[model samples]
Target: MLKKSLLLFSAACASASAESVSVYFGNGCFFDQQHTMVTRFEKLLLKRSGSDVTSVSAYAGGDSSSSDLCYHNEGEVEDYGKLGHAEVVELFIPDDKSLKDAAKVFFEDFTQLAPGQWTRQDVFDLGPEYRALVGIPGGVSGPYYSAIVEANSEVHNLNLKEGQGGDDDTIDTGVVWVMDSLKFPAYQAEVCLQFSDDNPAFSEPYSEKYHSLRDALFEEGTLRNTTCPTNYIC
Candidate 1:
Protein backbone atom coordinates (compact mmCIF):
# COMPACT_ATOMS: atom_id res chain seq x y z
CA MET A 1 0.00 0.00 0.00
CA LEU A 2 3.00 2.23 0.50
CA LYS A 3 5.17 3.42 -2.39
CA LYS A 4 8.98 3.57 -2.13
CA SER A 5 10.43 6.37 -4.11
CA LEU A 6 11.72 9.90 -3.42
CA LEU A 7 11.12 11.29 -6.92
CA LEU A 8 7.65 12.44 -5.91
CA PHE A 9 9.20 14.51 -3.12
CA SER A 10 10.33 17.16 -5.60
CA ALA A 11 6.85 17.54 -7.06
CA ALA A 12 5.28 17.66 -3.63
CA CYS A 13 7.78 20.28 -2.63
CA ALA A 14 6.79 22.31 -5.67
CA SER A 15 3.05 22.03 -5.12
CA ALA A 16 3.32 22.33 -1.34
CA SER A 17 2.40 25.72 0.07
CA ALA A 18 5.10 28.10 1.20
CA GLU A 19 3.95 27.93 4.80
CA SER A 20 6.11 26.04 7.33
CA VAL A 21 5.14 22.72 8.92
CA SER A 22 6.24 21.27 12.22
CA VAL A 23 6.29 17.51 12.70
CA TYR A 24 7.34 14.90 15.30
CA PHE A 25 8.94 11.54 14.59
CA GLY A 26 9.70 8.47 16.71
CA ASN A 27 11.41 5.47 15.19
CA GLY A 28 13.67 4.08 17.86
CA CYS A 29 15.62 4.82 20.98
CA PHE A 30 16.65 8.48 21.01
CA PHE A 31 19.85 7.82 22.85
CA ASP A 32 22.71 7.85 20.34
CA GLN A 33 20.79 6.10 17.59
CA GLN A 34 17.90 8.21 16.27
CA HIS A 35 19.35 11.11 18.21
CA THR A 36 22.09 11.31 15.61
CA MET A 37 19.57 11.66 12.81
CA VAL A 38 18.18 14.85 14.33
CA THR A 39 21.52 16.59 14.11
CA ARG A 40 22.10 15.34 10.59
CA PHE A 41 18.66 16.34 9.34
CA GLU A 42 19.05 19.67 11.06
CA LYS A 43 22.29 20.45 9.26
CA LEU A 44 20.68 19.82 5.87
CA LEU A 45 17.01 20.73 6.42
CA LEU A 46 17.41 23.71 8.74
CA LYS A 47 17.42 26.23 5.90
CA ARG A 48 13.70 25.69 5.18
CA SER A 49 12.55 23.56 8.09
CA GLY A 50 13.89 26.14 10.60
CA SER A 51 16.87 26.06 12.90
CA ASP A 52 14.95 24.87 15.95
CA VAL A 53 14.93 21.17 15.07
CA THR A 54 15.17 19.09 18.23
CA SER A 55 15.53 15.40 19.03
CA VAL A 56 13.20 15.42 22.00
CA SER A 57 13.51 12.03 23.68
CA ALA A 58 10.13 11.12 25.10
CA TYR A 59 7.76 8.49 26.44
CA ALA A 60 4.76 8.33 24.12
CA GLY A 61 1.92 6.24 22.66
CA GLY A 62 0.63 5.02 25.95
CA ASP A 63 -1.88 5.50 28.74
CA SER A 64 -1.24 8.74 30.60
CA SER A 65 1.60 10.47 32.36
CA SER A 66 -0.86 11.38 35.13
CA SER A 67 -1.27 7.67 35.74
CA ASP A 68 2.45 7.07 36.00
CA LEU A 69 5.78 8.83 36.19
CA CYS A 70 8.66 8.56 33.66
CA TYR A 71 12.36 7.66 33.81
CA HIS A 72 11.92 4.71 36.13
CA ASN A 73 12.02 0.97 35.75
CA GLU A 74 8.85 -0.95 34.96
CA GLY A 75 6.60 -0.90 38.02
CA GLU A 76 3.11 -1.93 39.01
CA VAL A 77 2.06 1.71 38.70
CA GLU A 78 4.87 4.21 38.13
CA ASP A 79 6.20 2.50 35.02
CA TYR A 80 6.67 4.00 31.58
CA GLY A 81 6.32 0.63 29.91
CA LYS A 82 3.02 -0.09 31.60
CA LEU A 83 1.90 3.40 30.67
CA GLY A 84 2.34 2.38 27.03
CA HIS A 85 4.89 5.10 26.51
CA ALA A 86 7.19 4.35 23.61
CA GLU A 87 10.74 5.52 23.55
CA VAL A 88 10.45 8.28 20.97
CA VAL A 89 12.13 11.31 19.54
CA GLU A 90 9.68 14.16 19.30
CA LEU A 91 11.08 16.05 16.31
CA PHE A 92 10.13 19.69 15.91
CA ILE A 93 9.93 20.18 12.18
CA PRO A 94 8.99 23.76 11.29
CA ASP A 95 8.60 22.91 7.60
CA ASP A 96 7.06 20.07 5.68
CA LYS A 97 10.29 18.28 4.81
CA SER A 98 8.27 15.15 4.12
CA LEU A 99 8.23 12.17 6.46
CA LYS A 100 10.38 10.30 3.97
CA ASP A 101 13.42 12.42 4.71
CA ALA A 102 12.90 12.06 8.42
CA ALA A 103 12.23 8.34 8.18
CA LYS A 104 15.15 7.71 5.87
CA VAL A 105 17.68 9.27 8.15
CA PHE A 106 16.18 8.02 11.40
CA PHE A 107 15.61 4.45 10.25
CA GLU A 108 17.93 3.74 7.35
CA ASP A 109 20.94 5.77 8.28
CA PHE A 110 22.83 5.99 11.59
CA THR A 111 22.50 2.29 12.22
CA GLN A 112 24.59 -0.13 14.22
CA LEU A 113 24.98 -2.56 11.34
CA ALA A 114 26.01 0.14 8.91
CA PRO A 115 24.58 3.10 7.02
CA GLY A 116 21.66 1.94 4.84
CA GLN A 117 21.98 -1.56 6.25
CA TRP A 118 18.24 -1.85 6.94
CA THR A 119 19.03 -4.59 9.40
CA ARG A 120 16.30 -3.41 11.79
CA GLN A 121 18.87 -3.84 14.52
CA ASP A 122 19.21 -0.10 14.99
CA VAL A 123 18.11 -0.01 18.60
CA PHE A 124 19.17 -1.78 21.78
CA ASP A 125 15.69 -2.46 23.08
CA LEU A 126 12.28 -3.60 21.76
CA GLY A 127 9.16 -1.98 23.15
CA PRO A 128 6.49 0.66 22.47
CA GLU A 129 9.09 3.35 22.91
CA TYR A 130 11.05 1.98 19.97
CA ARG A 131 8.10 1.81 17.63
CA ALA A 132 8.30 3.74 14.34
CA LEU A 133 6.04 6.75 14.33
CA VAL A 134 5.42 9.97 12.39
CA GLY A 135 3.16 12.64 13.75
CA ILE A 136 1.81 15.82 12.22
CA PRO A 137 0.47 18.63 14.34
CA GLY A 138 -3.25 17.88 13.84
CA GLY A 139 -3.25 14.19 12.99
CA VAL A 140 -2.17 11.80 10.22
CA SER A 141 -4.82 12.62 7.59
CA GLY A 142 -6.26 15.27 5.30
CA PRO A 143 -4.40 17.45 2.83
CA TYR A 144 -1.42 17.97 5.04
CA TYR A 145 -0.92 14.24 5.48
CA SER A 146 -1.41 13.70 1.76
CA ALA A 147 0.98 16.49 0.97
CA ILE A 148 3.67 15.10 3.21
CA VAL A 149 3.02 11.55 2.06
CA GLU A 150 3.06 12.66 -1.56
CA ALA A 151 6.27 14.47 -0.84
CA ASN A 152 7.43 11.32 0.82
CA SER A 153 6.37 9.28 -2.21
CA GLU A 154 9.42 10.72 -3.90
CA VAL A 155 11.42 7.95 -2.24
CA HIS A 156 8.87 5.18 -2.50
CA ASN A 157 11.48 3.39 -4.54
CA LEU A 158 13.80 3.37 -1.57
CA ASN A 159 11.30 1.30 0.41
CA LEU A 160 11.18 3.26 3.63
CA LYS A 161 9.16 0.51 5.30
CA GLU A 162 11.07 -2.39 3.83
CA GLY A 163 11.80 -5.13 6.36
CA GLN A 164 9.16 -3.33 8.37
CA GLY A 165 11.98 -1.18 9.57
CA GLY A 166 13.37 -4.51 10.79
CA ASP A 167 10.77 -4.77 13.53
CA ASP A 168 7.50 -6.69 13.86
CA ASP A 169 6.05 -4.77 16.81
CA THR A 170 4.69 -1.91 14.69
CA ILE A 171 1.21 -0.44 14.83
CA ASP A 172 1.05 -1.29 11.15
CA THR A 173 2.74 -3.67 8.76
CA GLY A 174 6.29 -2.41 8.46
CA VAL A 175 5.04 1.14 8.14
CA VAL A 176 5.70 3.96 10.53
CA TRP A 177 2.36 4.74 12.14
CA VAL A 178 1.11 8.28 11.38
CA MET A 179 -0.88 9.96 14.09
CA ASP A 180 -1.83 13.33 15.47
CA SER A 181 1.13 14.33 17.57
CA LEU A 182 -1.15 16.53 19.62
CA LYS A 183 -3.24 13.56 20.63
CA PHE A 184 -0.33 11.31 21.57
CA PRO A 185 1.65 13.72 23.63
CA ALA A 186 5.25 12.88 24.43
CA TYR A 187 6.57 12.94 27.99
CA GLN A 188 9.99 14.46 27.63
CA ALA A 189 12.70 12.18 28.92
CA GLU A 190 15.16 13.11 31.63
CA VAL A 191 16.97 16.42 31.11
CA CYS A 192 20.32 14.78 31.76
CA LEU A 193 19.97 12.57 28.64
CA GLN A 194 19.71 15.69 26.50
CA PHE A 195 22.92 16.86 28.06
CA SER A 196 25.25 16.99 25.11
CA ASP A 197 28.42 14.97 25.08
CA ASP A 198 29.82 18.08 23.39
CA ASN A 199 30.19 15.92 20.31
CA PRO A 200 28.69 16.62 16.92
CA ALA A 201 28.41 13.15 15.41
CA PHE A 202 26.84 10.18 17.22
CA SER A 203 27.19 7.46 14.59
CA GLU A 204 30.11 5.37 13.46
CA PRO A 205 31.74 7.93 11.21
CA TYR A 206 30.80 10.52 13.79
CA SER A 207 32.42 11.11 17.14
CA GLU A 208 32.83 8.14 19.47
CA LYS A 209 32.02 9.98 22.66
CA TYR A 210 28.28 10.72 22.26
CA HIS A 211 27.48 8.30 25.06
CA SER A 212 30.09 9.37 27.57
CA LEU A 213 28.21 11.32 30.25
CA ARG A 214 24.79 10.06 29.17
CA ASP A 215 26.04 6.53 29.60
CA ALA A 216 27.40 7.54 32.93
CA LEU A 217 23.97 8.85 33.86
CA PHE A 218 22.29 5.66 32.70
CA GLU A 219 24.48 3.75 35.11
CA GLU A 220 23.69 6.13 37.94
CA GLY A 221 19.92 6.10 37.45
CA THR A 222 17.18 8.75 38.02
CA LEU A 223 17.26 12.42 36.97
CA ARG A 224 20.74 13.64 37.80
CA ASN A 225 20.36 11.56 40.94
CA THR A 226 23.28 9.23 40.56
CA THR A 227 26.46 8.58 42.46
CA CYS A 228 29.47 8.40 40.22
CA PRO A 229 32.57 6.28 40.65
CA THR A 230 35.15 7.73 42.97
CA ASN A 231 37.23 8.75 39.98
CA TYR A 232 34.32 10.72 38.40
CA ILE A 233 31.90 13.38 39.56
CA CYS A 234 28.15 12.93 39.63
Candidate 2:
Protein backbone atom coordinates (compact mmCIF):
# COMPACT_ATOMS: atom_id res chain seq x y z
CA MET A 1 0.00 0.00 0.00
CA LEU A 2 2.88 2.35 0.82
CA LYS A 3 5.53 2.77 -1.90
CA LYS A 4 8.55 4.12 -0.09
CA SER A 5 11.88 2.94 1.34
CA LEU A 6 11.98 1.89 5.02
CA LEU A 7 13.99 4.92 5.96
CA LEU A 8 14.76 7.96 3.83
CA PHE A 9 18.35 6.74 3.59
CA SER A 10 19.51 9.05 0.83
CA ALA A 11 18.21 12.19 2.48
CA ALA A 12 18.88 11.09 6.07
CA CYS A 13 22.35 9.93 5.25
CA ALA A 14 23.07 13.16 3.46
CA SER A 15 22.02 15.22 6.46
CA ALA A 16 23.14 13.22 9.49
CA SER A 17 26.47 11.73 10.41
CA ALA A 18 27.08 8.02 11.05
CA GLU A 19 26.47 8.52 14.76
CA SER A 20 22.77 9.00 14.19
CA VAL A 21 21.37 6.03 12.28
CA SER A 22 17.90 4.68 11.61
CA VAL A 23 17.52 0.91 11.91
CA TYR A 24 14.30 -1.00 11.30
CA PHE A 25 12.91 -4.30 12.62
CA GLY A 26 9.76 -6.38 12.37
CA ASN A 27 9.27 -6.66 16.14
CA GLY A 28 5.98 -8.47 16.36
CA CYS A 29 2.41 -7.47 17.30
CA PHE A 30 2.79 -3.88 16.13
CA PHE A 31 -0.88 -3.20 16.71
CA ASP A 32 -2.76 -3.44 19.96
CA GLN A 33 -6.35 -2.52 20.78
CA GLN A 34 -5.47 -1.97 24.43
CA HIS A 35 -4.20 1.58 24.63
CA THR A 36 -2.50 1.29 28.04
CA MET A 37 -0.61 -1.85 27.01
CA VAL A 38 0.66 -0.16 23.86
CA THR A 39 1.90 2.91 25.67
CA ARG A 40 3.60 0.85 28.36
CA PHE A 41 5.50 -1.12 25.75
CA GLU A 42 6.44 2.05 23.89
CA LYS A 43 7.89 3.41 27.09
CA LEU A 44 9.78 0.19 27.69
CA LEU A 45 11.34 0.34 24.23
CA LEU A 46 12.39 3.94 24.82
CA LYS A 47 13.64 3.36 28.36
CA ARG A 48 15.50 0.05 28.13
CA SER A 49 17.09 0.84 24.83
CA GLY A 50 18.38 3.95 26.66
CA SER A 51 17.69 6.12 23.65
CA ASP A 52 15.16 8.76 22.76
CA VAL A 53 14.02 6.69 19.82
CA THR A 54 10.95 7.27 17.67
CA SER A 55 9.06 4.19 16.52
CA VAL A 56 6.04 3.07 14.47
CA SER A 57 4.05 -0.05 13.72
CA ALA A 58 5.25 -0.95 10.24
CA TYR A 59 5.00 -3.69 7.57
CA ALA A 60 7.92 -5.47 5.98
CA GLY A 61 9.58 -8.78 4.83
CA GLY A 62 7.21 -10.11 2.18
CA ASP A 63 6.82 -9.92 -1.57
CA SER A 64 4.76 -7.12 -3.07
CA SER A 65 4.49 -5.33 -6.42
CA SER A 66 6.56 -2.75 -4.59
CA SER A 67 8.56 -2.71 -1.33
CA ASP A 68 6.24 -0.35 0.58
CA LEU A 69 3.02 -1.55 2.25
CA CYS A 70 0.39 -0.36 4.76
CA TYR A 71 -1.39 -1.87 7.78
CA HIS A 72 -5.17 -2.24 7.50
CA ASN A 73 -7.26 -2.82 10.62
CA GLU A 74 -8.80 -6.20 9.79
CA GLY A 75 -11.45 -7.77 11.94
CA GLU A 76 -11.58 -11.18 10.26
CA VAL A 77 -8.24 -11.08 8.52
CA GLU A 78 -5.04 -10.10 10.32
CA ASP A 79 -3.12 -6.93 9.55
CA TYR A 80 -1.33 -7.15 6.20
CA GLY A 81 -1.89 -10.90 6.08
CA LYS A 82 -3.12 -10.92 2.48
CA LEU A 83 0.03 -9.16 1.34
CA GLY A 84 2.36 -11.45 3.39
CA HIS A 85 4.02 -8.52 5.11
CA ALA A 86 5.32 -8.78 8.68
CA GLU A 87 4.36 -6.26 11.39
CA VAL A 88 7.50 -4.33 12.20
CA VAL A 89 8.80 -1.34 14.11
CA GLU A 90 10.89 1.29 12.42
CA LEU A 91 13.08 3.06 15.02
CA PHE A 92 14.93 6.31 14.63
CA ILE A 93 18.12 6.04 16.75
CA PRO A 94 19.54 9.36 17.77
CA ASP A 95 23.14 10.60 17.70
CA ASP A 96 26.07 8.69 19.31
CA LYS A 97 24.18 5.44 19.21
CA SER A 98 24.85 2.36 17.06
CA LEU A 99 22.80 -0.54 15.77
CA LYS A 100 23.73 -2.58 18.86
CA ASP A 101 21.71 -0.26 21.07
CA ALA A 102 18.64 -1.19 19.06
CA ALA A 103 19.77 -4.79 18.91
CA LYS A 104 20.00 -5.06 22.68
CA VAL A 105 16.37 -4.01 23.02
CA PHE A 106 15.25 -6.37 20.26
CA PHE A 107 16.81 -9.42 21.83
CA GLU A 108 16.46 -8.58 25.51
CA ASP A 109 13.19 -6.65 25.74
CA PHE A 110 10.84 -9.61 26.11
CA THR A 111 11.05 -13.21 27.14
CA GLN A 112 9.92 -14.29 23.67
CA LEU A 113 10.26 -11.74 20.88
CA ALA A 114 8.14 -13.47 18.22
CA PRO A 115 5.07 -11.59 17.03
CA GLY A 116 1.57 -12.21 18.36
CA GLN A 117 0.43 -13.97 21.52
CA TRP A 118 -1.44 -16.95 20.03
CA THR A 119 -0.50 -19.14 17.08
CA ARG A 120 -2.39 -19.10 13.76
CA GLN A 121 -4.56 -22.12 14.63
CA ASP A 122 -6.27 -20.43 17.56
CA VAL A 123 -9.60 -18.67 16.98
CA PHE A 124 -8.01 -15.67 18.63
CA ASP A 125 -5.12 -16.01 16.25
CA LEU A 126 -3.38 -12.74 15.47
CA GLY A 127 -1.99 -14.38 12.31
CA PRO A 128 1.58 -14.72 11.10
CA GLU A 129 2.19 -11.07 10.27
CA TYR A 130 4.14 -10.91 13.50
CA ARG A 131 7.62 -12.33 12.76
CA ALA A 132 10.81 -11.28 14.51
CA LEU A 133 13.44 -9.97 12.13
CA VAL A 134 16.12 -7.26 11.90
CA GLY A 135 17.26 -5.25 8.91
CA ILE A 136 20.27 -3.10 8.13
CA PRO A 137 20.26 -1.07 4.98
CA GLY A 138 23.09 -0.36 2.46
CA GLY A 139 24.94 -3.63 3.14
CA VAL A 140 27.23 -1.44 5.15
CA SER A 141 29.92 -3.31 7.03
CA GLY A 142 31.48 -2.16 10.28
CA PRO A 143 31.32 -2.60 14.05
CA TYR A 144 27.61 -1.89 14.08
CA TYR A 145 26.77 -4.68 11.66
CA SER A 146 29.14 -7.01 13.45
CA ALA A 147 27.48 -6.19 16.77
CA ILE A 148 24.03 -7.13 15.42
CA VAL A 149 25.31 -10.37 13.90
CA GLU A 150 27.15 -11.25 17.08
CA ALA A 151 24.30 -10.53 19.49
CA ASN A 152 21.75 -12.36 17.36
CA SER A 153 23.96 -15.41 17.09
CA GLU A 154 24.74 -15.38 20.80
CA VAL A 155 21.05 -15.21 21.72
CA HIS A 156 20.41 -18.35 19.71
CA ASN A 157 23.68 -19.96 20.85
CA LEU A 158 24.66 -20.17 17.19
CA ASN A 159 28.03 -20.22 15.55
CA LEU A 160 28.77 -18.29 12.41
CA LYS A 161 27.83 -20.24 9.28
CA GLU A 162 30.65 -18.86 7.18
CA GLY A 163 30.50 -18.55 3.38
CA GLN A 164 26.74 -18.31 3.80
CA GLY A 165 26.76 -14.57 4.45
CA GLY A 166 28.31 -12.27 7.02
CA ASP A 167 30.99 -13.88 9.17
CA ASP A 168 28.60 -13.81 12.11
CA ASP A 169 25.34 -14.15 10.22
CA THR A 170 22.51 -16.49 11.12
CA ILE A 171 19.97 -17.06 8.36
CA ASP A 172 17.30 -18.22 10.78
CA THR A 173 17.59 -18.41 14.54
CA GLY A 174 14.65 -20.87 14.48
CA VAL A 175 12.72 -17.84 15.76
CA VAL A 176 14.26 -14.73 14.19
CA TRP A 177 15.35 -13.82 10.67
CA VAL A 178 18.28 -11.52 10.03
CA MET A 179 18.79 -9.90 6.65
CA ASP A 180 19.43 -6.76 4.69
CA SER A 181 16.34 -4.52 4.72
CA LEU A 182 16.56 -3.94 0.97
CA LYS A 183 15.58 -7.57 0.44
CA PHE A 184 12.07 -6.97 1.85
CA PRO A 185 11.45 -3.29 2.30
CA ALA A 186 9.48 -1.33 4.97
CA TYR A 187 7.63 1.97 4.95
CA GLN A 188 5.34 4.12 7.10
CA ALA A 189 2.15 2.46 8.29
CA GLU A 190 -1.24 4.20 8.17
CA VAL A 191 -1.03 7.71 9.62
CA CYS A 192 -3.59 7.52 12.46
CA LEU A 193 -1.61 4.50 13.54
CA GLN A 194 1.60 6.51 13.50
CA PHE A 195 2.44 7.37 17.11
CA SER A 196 -0.63 5.77 18.68
CA ASP A 197 -0.75 6.56 22.43
CA ASP A 198 2.63 8.25 22.78
CA ASN A 199 2.90 12.00 22.62
CA PRO A 200 4.30 13.67 19.49
CA ALA A 201 7.02 15.28 21.62
CA PHE A 202 8.54 11.86 22.27
CA SER A 203 9.09 11.21 18.56
CA GLU A 204 10.41 14.60 17.47
CA PRO A 205 8.61 16.88 15.00
CA TYR A 206 7.50 14.02 12.75
CA SER A 207 4.94 12.74 15.26
CA GLU A 208 3.16 16.09 15.38
CA LYS A 209 2.93 16.31 11.60
CA TYR A 210 1.99 12.63 11.30
CA HIS A 211 -1.02 13.16 13.60
CA SER A 212 -2.30 15.94 11.37
CA LEU A 213 -1.64 13.90 8.25
CA ARG A 214 -3.32 10.90 9.87
CA ASP A 215 -6.41 13.03 10.46
CA ALA A 216 -6.41 13.93 6.76
CA LEU A 217 -5.87 10.34 5.62
CA PHE A 218 -8.53 8.55 7.66
CA GLU A 219 -12.02 9.47 8.75
CA GLU A 220 -12.97 9.94 12.39
CA GLY A 221 -13.01 6.65 14.30
CA THR A 222 -11.88 4.74 11.16
CA LEU A 223 -8.69 4.11 13.07
CA ARG A 224 -8.42 4.24 16.86
CA ASN A 225 -7.50 7.76 17.90
CA THR A 226 -4.47 7.93 20.20
CA THR A 227 -5.59 7.63 23.81
CA CYS A 228 -4.50 9.85 26.67
CA PRO A 229 -0.76 10.19 27.14
CA THR A 230 0.60 8.29 30.18
CA ASN A 231 3.81 10.28 30.30
CA TYR A 232 4.88 13.47 28.57
CA ILE A 233 7.79 11.73 26.86
CA CYS A 234 10.50 9.28 27.81
TM-score of each: 0.58, 0.52
Give a tens-digit lDDT track for model 2, residues 78-105.
Answer: 3345666665676545432345545655
Query: Which has the greatest TM-score?
Result: 1
- Model 2, which residues run further than 4 Å from truth? 1-4, 7-15, 18-20, 31-53, 73-79, 94-97, 112-125, 138-144, 153-174, 197-234
* Candidate 1 weakest lDDT stretch, 10 residues: 225-234
Please list the C-alpha lDDT of all candidates, in the order they appear.
0.45, 0.43
- In the predicted model 2, the residue pairs found to clash are none
The C-alpha local distance difference test score for the whole of candidate 1 amounts to 0.45
Assess candidate 1 and give its TM-score to the true structure.
0.58
RMSD of each: 10.8, 10.6
